[model samples]
Target chain A: IAGITQAPTSQILAAGRRMTLRCTQDMRHNAMYWYRQDLGLGLRLIHYSNTAGTTGKGEVPDGYSVSRANTDDFPLTLASAVPSQTSVYFCASSDGQGAEAFFGQGTRLTVV
Target chain B: TQLLEQSPQFLSIQEGENLTVYCNSSSVFSSLQWYRQEPGEGPVLLVTVVTGGEVKKLKRLTFQFGDARKDSSLHITAAQPGDTGLYLCAGWANNLFFGTGTRLTVIP
Candidate 1:
């Protein structure tokens, strides 16, 4: 089962452009998250959705936004990409709080 | 924000050798999780220790969580080359805070 899958495995976009990274899960999990990994900085949460119709800001939420329209998908958008946004993005989900999470392959975004 | 500090930022050793990686923090957590991630792949959970002073074993890997819930460790015995990956420890506060991963390279 493709537990979780992210679209646009890698992307290169010019600054000031808008882009959305797609994430989907087949497990029907209730919690979904977005995180970015930078060298030596660890993975920091960008945004998260506790369930459909509800979202919350995470540790690093500026420059990024997310929406959870249904249980299967939660997409992260960069309305105005910047060079500082170059990083690998990951999508994850859990059946519930404090549970084991499954992650997507990842989206490597380069904002030039 | 709660912070998790992992030690031995990098580790390289030959097969059959033993090594330990640590994750420490000043903030107590309700639960801590361990994940191993490879290049091009997202972090995958290896295990979770919720109880203070708890210990869990997965094959050759032994995981321990400090009673104070402020530290954790993973010890690998007779490590194999397949064990190479970035190991991370995460602490939870409603959401999880990941530590600087310990990159392990097991030489064959």
Candidate 2:
């Protein structure tokens, strides 16, 4: 059903560059989230959108931003990539708050 | 900030062995969820426990929520090579707070 689709499955970017990780879901979920997974440091929420046209900061919101223009799309952007930002980024969505969340395949980002 | 802590960050065992993983937190949660992630993939939900002291079983996996709803445990019996993956616990306190995750490797 293509529950969630993420673009640029893997990317290698130079520091100080701008990048956007695209995420789209067909489930029409109202809540979407962006998280980064690093070794020894599970998934840390970067940003979240309770519904379209609204967004909020998560645990690790620095250096990252997200926009939920509609129910199906929530994109996360890195204003200026840094080497420390290299990690696997995951996009997830749920029917509503506290519901089981389904995640995208993931975007492997490597900044040099 | 609410934090979920998972013990034994990594584990390796022979196939058919039994093992247990733990997830603990200082804050109480209305619900807790368990997820498993394999290489090059995102975490996928395995089960969710809503009530305190609830126990749920899924084939060889057994999940239990603490009476206080501040802790959880996952026990796998007769593990197989296919059971290898990263196990994560997430608690719902307004939002989901994920644990550090336990990486399990079952060798044949």
Candidate 3:
């Protein structure tokens, strides 16, 4: 299996700009998630989807948005980038709630 | 926010040595998982412990979940240089909450 793949492996943006991090999984999982990993900190959830069409806000969703249009894709959007939003973003998918979650390679974003 | 804490943030040891990494939480979870990641890559699942007081082994690595379902540990026996990477523990709350991660460096 191709497992999980994330787009724009790394990016640099100016403040107030917009960006979207893309994630796709071929595992056909029902739950998809977005998380941000900061230096020396644990992975913090940004958003999640229970299935193809449902999405929910997570711990750190203030400046981010997400969409789950199908079983294979989840895109996380940063509406207005800020320096505090600079972190590596990870995408994960699980077959069911509380099940094993497979993660994508993650996108390293830097907002200047 | 549900938090997963990992201990000994960083560890460095000789090739034949052993070490253990821990992940603890204050909330209950149905399942706990362990993952390993190298520089610039996504985490890869290592083991999943579902039952309370569960124990699972993957080669030289042993994984255990606390009886209360809020803690877990990963022990590596006779570590190798290839084991050098970031080890992370995760549990599902609303989604997956990853631990702070233990960066291990096994020297030859």
Clashing pairs in 3: none
DockQ of each: 0.68, 0.71, 0.67
> What is the per-residue lDDT of model 2 for residues B6-82, given as tens digits with 9 covering 90 to 100?
99899999999999999999999999999999998889999999999999999999999999999999999999999
Considering every candidate listed, which one attains the maximal TM-score? 2
lDDT of candidate 1 over A21-109, digit per residue (tens):
99999999999999999888779889999899999999889999999999999999999999999999999999876799889999999
TM-score, per-candidate, Cα-based: 0.96, 0.98, 0.95
Model 2 off-target regions past 4 Å? none
For residue A76, give model 2's deviation from the true position in Å.
Answer: 0.5
**Residue runs of model 1 more than 4 Å from their true location after superposition:** none
User: Model 2's lDDT to the true fold?
Assistant: 0.94
How would the candidate models be sorted by lDDT, starting from the highest?
2, 1, 3
Model 2: docking quality category: medium
**lDDT, model 3, position A67:** 87
Model 3: per-residue Cα lDDT over B8-88, one tens digit each: 899999999989998999988888989898888878889888899999999999999999999999999999999999999
Candidates ranked by DockQ: 2, 1, 3
Error of 2 at B87 (Å): 0.5
What lDDT does each candidate get? Answer: 0.93, 0.94, 0.89
